[model samples]
Target chain A: MATVNWRTINIDALDPDSPANFDLSTLTATVAPVSTADVQSLAGQIRQLLRGGDNEGALQGALENPPYGADERGKDVHLATVIEILQSIRQSDMSPMLGRIYKSPGGTEALDVLMKYIYKGMSQTNAASTTRNITPQATGFSQIHSRGGGEGGGQAMSVLLSWHEKVVEIAGPGCIVRVMTDRRTV
Target chain B: MGPPEVHHLFHHPIADHSFSADRQTLAVARENNVDLYQRAGGKFQLKDELTGHDKTVTGVDIAPNTGKIVTCSQDRNAYVWEPSPQGWKPTLVLLRINRAATCVRWAPSETKFAVGSGARLIPVCYFEEEDNWWVSKHLKKPIRSTITTVAWHPNSVLLAAGSTDGHARVFSSFVKGVDSRPEPSAWGERLPFNTVCGEFLNNTAGWVHSVAFSPSGNALAFAAHDSSLTVVYPSAPEQPPRAVISISTQLLPFKSLVWSSESEIIAAGFDCEAYRLQGSEQSWQLAGSLESKGRPGVQDHREESALNMFKQMDLKGKVTDDTKLKTVHQNTISTIRVFEAGAGTVRKISTSGVDGRVVIWTL
Candidate 1:
């Protein structure tokens, strides 16, 4: 007699839970397409806010209206500004900033947008690190230099992870689910 | 005002269900068959079964005046069943699509019907007198994804469809020979086949699960996966809508909804209970749940004796029996249909769920 492993069975194939059954594209809003020029101007404004030592304003500006219709390049530019603002804020001020944002109107949606950016940044950092690991023929001196760069990337990742933990705590788990299912690009 | 009538038919999910005009016969899509139940002794008893498709039947609708039954299935086929002296006869419809049909609804006039499919198009099927068979004309353009549900206007010329693309669109299904010229309304004047009348998106871009036209067919309401119900009223052709009111709810997403009147909408889904929403075109809000708070059989306190606990753990390894829900329907309500109506107001409504229970609620 043969024993069956129910855990290993593909339940989605038997049920109607397959990804092919539901198209993710249908979950996106049909907003007017955003061009690269609009994103460039928004990025310049956020950079100015950061230069004036207004990190909270810069972060809120970056999150107020994500370019849902922008191309990859436009999204990357906006994401870089958001990362800069996140890095500038001290660890002690994280909870207070999040508390204020969560209590404000439309705060839940803004936090959801921030969650999307955090996940995107983490994935990109992981991809870059994996690509560097694929080429193992580096000399000892180059390896040392790469290790230093890897430590910087690791620090950035930890900061993002901490922010993720705080956002989930403030917004509840629904924010994460909303970010995953939301089709609006950030 | 009274306890709802519940009939637990079987332990299988009912994808859709419909009642005859006389309210004596009930048709439900169960698994791969359409089961017809006759009202006997104040209860529904299985009287006949219509089985043809090899896959699960997704939708079933019985014509009120014509006494014809139309069913669609996941096998990419549809059949029209007619009663004769010998038995019910089935006629195959030429849908001409390779994907599974999701839903089917007969027009108010009973002259035609619209079928939504996974192929991302709606096929409006009508009988061809010359060919002596049912044929379909596809509504193909501008639809980006699979259509989940479709509704027909009161005039039988306009059709509303909710699609996975997060859009609830109203289209002109005016077949030249089948439909007469409709009067100019807020939708448009020159209504032709495949004319796009209006398109509205959900607030959060969630998949539109259900779409319905009001009793007068003047307003459109849709429930999306974001747990929000949106109502759209068109002001005129090629202009902005008069009002687009959205009511967000804390309940789970609604799978089906029906208008009780011009001012009230009843919706239900995974929450396992029905809700009442009321408003005009200006604004809308969640009225409350339809389930009475003081219904019988709701055990507020359970005796927690040590012997009882030990016996329960000895029998099932669980402390409490939390299987039953407080609501009438134990699982997700899959479909809701108007059971009885008079003077443009729904007097009674019927709901069916995955728990295989069909419940009738008196409004």
Candidate 2:
């Protein structure tokens, strides 16, 4: 047998950070560390709501306390961990846990409630926390490494946006595309 | 053009598939076993399963004339299944390689077949009357890495192999006493066993994912990992090729392709939809996607209500609910084969994908 030198080329290392094309600069804004104390207390309540399996209640708490502040790393960590847990709950099930909720009565209303919470929660992180933007950007798989970069407001929005993207991706493009092309509402 | 017929046979990824001559039996490589489905009431139902390999079965092909099935697996083995009254009988071919057999295909004559392997070799196998067994002759000289795909020439003597080493080569597997002397062609004139007839590499050093010979066997086309398809046309035996047309597309790399005609090639891959490429020996370009641009008539739109909004929000944490893709296949399309063919042209094509769907498209 003739000897041939073989080499393995990793497709990722050739072009790293292919998924960082999303412009997050406009999405991020600095927040003054004014409401740090209020957000921390609210996080405790959200934790209790999450433990009670009340996703809607937890979403409501997040919306009310919306954790926006500079130097509020403690609250940011708490909220991010909560979102991570919710995301896991949505993922671990065979059908999306949220999809089941959507099929249930008032599921859309609950989703809208959660959506409202997510909108506020996205703006809950500190603005000056751009230094904590150490999360590796997604390459292909929608695996978020850290809560997104934010003073406090952007991380929640990022999580919400990413969640929607993941759901759309998993559900096939039809779910959202059909919604976009529908003339019934008009 | 109604929607293509779809057979969602299994939940696992179908690595490869083949249809029997009568179009009744379908054999698919699913995990470690090859599952055969027979068409009944316009739908394929499970008929039998061939289980022998210890690892994942990578490729399967049915010889239409001989009514034989050949399968290879990651377990470094290939089995030829001959149909009998007692169902299909499996006979292990003496491949004598120590690496995973990636792909296998019976030649046009059904007398021989080629197995591409991770051992960096293409074994051209033929039956031996004296030994009463199938034995292979390894074309092991110039290949540098694992062979990903193989295609046999229409004459059944020349074999084309694509490898991870970023090269696609044409080797003469003209086994003595088995293959008669082929007429002079664009690939070569004088051919012998293991003769390297032609070798070509992609400009970007991309690993070739698939290789195909045009219906006439005068042209060769290969799809590479760089999302480009290169078509090669040779001039004469020792002369340089007349044209090497490389069309780099913006789409993902194609995993499989087949000649719709001498002038058209249909390819599909990670995009989950087939695309038509039209060309001559001088030039080639992507025509369009084989799928309809969009589904305009099938309206399943739910009335927009506060309830729907909340449901979307709760389930997907969004106000918009768009989960269904317009494409028939929801994932990567891995293989495309000619379903119905005429001389140097195909009328219908069948595609199987990672989503466990087998869709048949008409030309």
Candidate 3:
């Protein structure tokens, strides 16, 4: 008698990637797609607000409507605007800004959107550092840090990390879980 | 309340479990087989095993009115087990799908059942008297990914399905011959077969793990992978829902949830412990964990001897032994079902987990 080890076989590899097998429409956002021009205009407005020292307005504008249905380029533009707004806020004003965002109508959802951008910013910075291939200085007690970063990149990472910490402190850990599990792109 | 009653079965994950209407027999889906345990002297003894599926059994449900058992497996097949004098006889269901069946639930009327599958469709199977076999009609439209879990409405016509596409949808599985015209409700009127009554996406578009209809069939609740439970109350047919309340928890995501009543829901999953959420259709909040921690004598059971402390420090480089969690279930809970109900409210509930322990909690 002969028996085949069906479990060990790569069944998924054998199957063709067809629409009937996996529907792509379900994975995409149901919202209408955002055009590149619209994203650019929004980025310009957010940049103007940032320059005017309206950090809260800029952050709120960046988070109010995520480019859920945008293409990769459009989403990247929106993400860059969000990071610029996140970086413009003073360290002391971070808690108060988050508190105001949390207290406002639909503030919790805005915070969740902000969290998604924060994670995206962190990953992009990390990726840039890796591509640059900057060697770490072998200082005592700091060699234990595994993430590679240059001096400028490390400061940016610290800012993002502190924002992440404070976001979790205000929004609770659910924001992190939401950002990690959410499939809809920012 | 007192501590929950726990029975540690064999060391294997139980994907799903169901109790008979009389609550005398318990059926659990273990690895390739469905094991039946008889309730004897306040303990469950292994009675028999229904072994037919070649792959892992994903779901098992026992019909309440009729003592029939329905089991679906990852082998892309389903079986309806009928008790006979000789033994339990298994009848294969013609699912007509090429992918694994992930979950199964018998309709309240016991005339039909729905199987959620990786084929991105739900096959509503009903017995054909003339052919003397179980035939299925697929609900294919609007379903995008593998269905994770399915639930039947109290009327037996409406079915709710949760899928990996981050959607919980309510579809009419009204088989023309098997099911009668259901009464008009918030879901819809003149329910035809494959009618899309409602579709709800999770807040962050997380994969929905479990979806359930309320006891009254007027509301729907689903647990998603983002550690949130959302409850939707349909206002009127073709209109927006009156309320879609999502309660996010700090704990791990819930894999299974059951409505104890119209106002209360008990959910358990990766948290290893069950939690209770209570409120109305307008708003809801997490009440707390069902487990009452720091029970008397539980703390005393841990031995803090110097030798044990030294052994712990030498082995794991830690002074305290934190291997054991405070919760009863040592691993992720996979399923939660109502064990006993009275007067439209669940009195006791049962939960099984990866720890191979079945616990009964009085709510």
Which candidate leads in DockQ?
3
Listed in order, the DockQ scores are 0.18, 0.02, 0.44
Model 1: per-residue Cα lDDT over B1-363, one tens digit each: 888999999999999999999999999999999999999987999999998999999999999999999999999999999999977899999999879999999999899999999988999999999999999999987787889999998989999999988889999999988999998889888988999999998557777899999988889999988677899999999888899987655467889999999999999998888999999988898898889886777765576899999999999998888878888999999899998899989988999999999999988
lDDT of 2 at B102: 98
lDDT of model 3 at residue A86?
A: 78
User: Per-residue alpha-carbon lDDT of model 1 for A13-57, expressed as tens digits?
Assistant: 775544556566645556677898999999899989989988888
Q: For residues A71-144, could you state the per-residue lDDT of candidate 2 as single tens digits? A: 44655554564565455444345236556655565443334334433433444443345446544664654325
Q: Estimate each model's TM-score.
A: 0.79, 0.67, 0.87
lDDT, model 1, position B68: 100
lDDT winner between 1 and 2, please give it: 1
Kindly provide the TM-score of model 3 when superposed on the true structure, using C-alpha atoms. 0.87
Off by over 4 Å in 3: A1-23, A26-29, A32-58, A69-74, A88-100, A134-149, B297-303
Clashes of 1: 0
Q: TM-score: which is higher, 2 or 3?
A: 3
CA RMSD (A), model 1: 8.4
Instruction: List candidate 1 stretches off by more than 4 Å.
Output: A1-62, A69-180
Ranking by DockQ: 3, 1, 2
Superposed Cα deviation of residue B181, candidate 3 (Å): 3.0
